[model samples]
Target: MIRRISAALLALGLATAAFAQAAWTDAEVRKVDAKTGKITLKHGEIKNLDMPPMTMVFTAKDKALLEGVKAGDHVQFAADKDAAGEYVLTAIQQKK
Candidate 1:
């Protein structure tokens, strides 16, 4: 009985963690500076960051994250605050 209760609790924890994961935001690319590893975007509200819709620049966590992206492209992305407290683009993909 104790083992079953523990297993149930573990599963619940895992499910909650998955559900709490950051959501992707819709954005329009305003510029991509591969040289600086930065992208400017006019983006919708970033629910995870509690940010409202606005145009802003974000450093890409990896230069590769800028690949295939260009100005005027519609994309979906996820961002997070880095150790420096600056927003960093963590994931990005061209919208279908």
Candidate 2:
């Protein structure tokens, strides 16, 4: 019974984490630095990274991620820690 309970708990924890990480929150582009593939965003809850709503700068996995985005644009973006140990954008798009 104890083992079963532990397994259930573990599964629940994993599901919650996956759901959090998969969710994308809204943000406003404060700045876009195309040369460096970085952008400043004032974002809502980033549960995947355990970040609260705030303004900060982040690097993108690909420079092209910033190609058509500009300052003051509302966007939805996914961010994750890269192998280099920096949090970078995995995906992004302009909000409609």
Q: TM-score of each candidate?
A: 0.79, 0.75
User: Which residues of candidate 2, in runs, are more than 4 Å off?
Assistant: 1-21
List candidate 1 segments past 4 Å from native: 1-21
| lDDT on C-alpha atoms for all candidate structures | 0.94, 0.91
lDDT of 1 at 32: 95
**Every model: Cα RMSD to truth:** 3.8, 5.8
Scanning candidate 2 in windows of ten residues, the lowest lDDT window is 16-25
How far is 21's C-alpha from truth in model 1 (Å)?
4.8
Alpha carbon lDDT at 96, candidate 2: 69
Q: What is the lDDT of residue 10 in candidate 1?
A: 100
lDDT tens digits, residue span 1-96, model 1: 999999999999999997567588999999999999999999999998999999999999999999999999999999999998999999998898
lDDT of 2 by residue, 1-96 (tens): 999999999999999998666668799999999998899999999997898999999998999989999999999999989888898988898886
